[model samples]
Target: SHFIVGLTGGIGSGKTTVANLFAEQGIDLIDADIVAREVVEPGSEGLAAIVEHFGEHVLQSDGQLDRSALRECIFSQPKQRLWLNECLHPLIRKRMLELIKQSTSAYAVLVVPLLFENGLDSLVDRTLVVDISPELQIKRTQDRDGVDKGQIENIIRSQMPRQQRLDKTDDIIDNQGEIQEIEQTVFALHKQYLSLSKAVLS
Candidate 1:
């Protein structure tokens, strides 16, 4: 397997943007969020299991998962949230690993937003945390999603604390600056990862 870097960040910390920059350098990306969605698409067993447990109301008229409705239900009910995670986490992990094995790049980025919290760090050779101030995270999330500040705060509280996430990471990208700055940081990491991957192979 290629060397794996687990990339994570708090909500609205521009993780996807950073991932895109790495992708531009020809690194493969196995994104947990994307695989999470895939596991629950219309004909998938994941969606079928959800409908079985949470009922068909979790589905839209087109038979797709009603993500907003499911999100609201889970957030308001702790038991429901637990049950949903129990159902989805294994499926997500399975798919993520399968994709990672298919990568042919010098190194691959495994983008898991809950990398630390979910114990996904074990899957990677190194960890990268994209960091921003808490205030910036709150503002960016609210502005991007049009959600209430309270909701954004709650989501942040649910993840690993900011400093702890940084402390555990093998690399950190400070994402509070301009787009050009972030790009330059990612470019440097790309080269570093290439070297690290070769070292691992040797």
Candidate 2:
């Protein structure tokens, strides 16, 4: 198997940008959010199970899962969130490993937002934490998502804290800067990762 690197960040921490940098370097990136959505597509077994458990109220008029409705329900209720995770995480993990197995790059980057909270870090050989201050996280999230202060705080609080992520990481990329700086850092990291992978393989 290729060396697996798990990349994680708090909400609005520019994880997508970092992942894009890895992609540009020809690294295979398995994005959990994208995979999660795919697994729950209409008529899929995941959707069927979700509807069965959550009732049809979680669906929109077009018969697709209403993500907002589901988010609202889960965010307000920890048990509901846990139930949803129990239902979806395993399926997502199965599909993610399949994708990882198929990757043709020197290594793979698994971009999972909840990597720590869900213990998905065990799947990867190394963990890269994208660090940003909580103040910036809240501000960026508010500006980007139009969420109120309370909602942003709730979302931030719901995840593992920034310091905890830093504590658990094998590597840290501090991304609290301009886009160019972020790009430069990611570029450097990619080269380092490639070198590390080569050394391991040899």
Alpha-carbon lDDT, every model? 0.92, 0.89
Compared with the true structure, what per-residue lDDT tens digits does model 1 show for residues 96-138?
8888889899999999999999898998999999999999999
- Model 1 RMSD in Å is 1.8
- Per residue, candidate 2 scores C-alpha lDDT tens digits across 1-202 of 4789999999988888889889988899999999999999998889998898878999999989999888887886989988988999889999999999999899999999999998999999889988889899988888898879888888899899888999999988888888788787777878888888888899
Among these predictions, the greatest TM-score belongs to 1
Candidate 2, residue 202: the lDDT equals 95
Where does the lowest 10-residue lDDT sum fall in candidate 2?
178-187
Task: Quote model 1's TM-score.
Answer: 0.91
lDDT of 1: 0.92
Off by over 4 Å in 1: 72-76
Off by over 4 Å in 2: 68-80
Q: Estimate the TM-score of every prediction.
A: 0.91, 0.89
Best by lDDT: 1
User: lDDT of model 2 at residue 129?
Assistant: 88
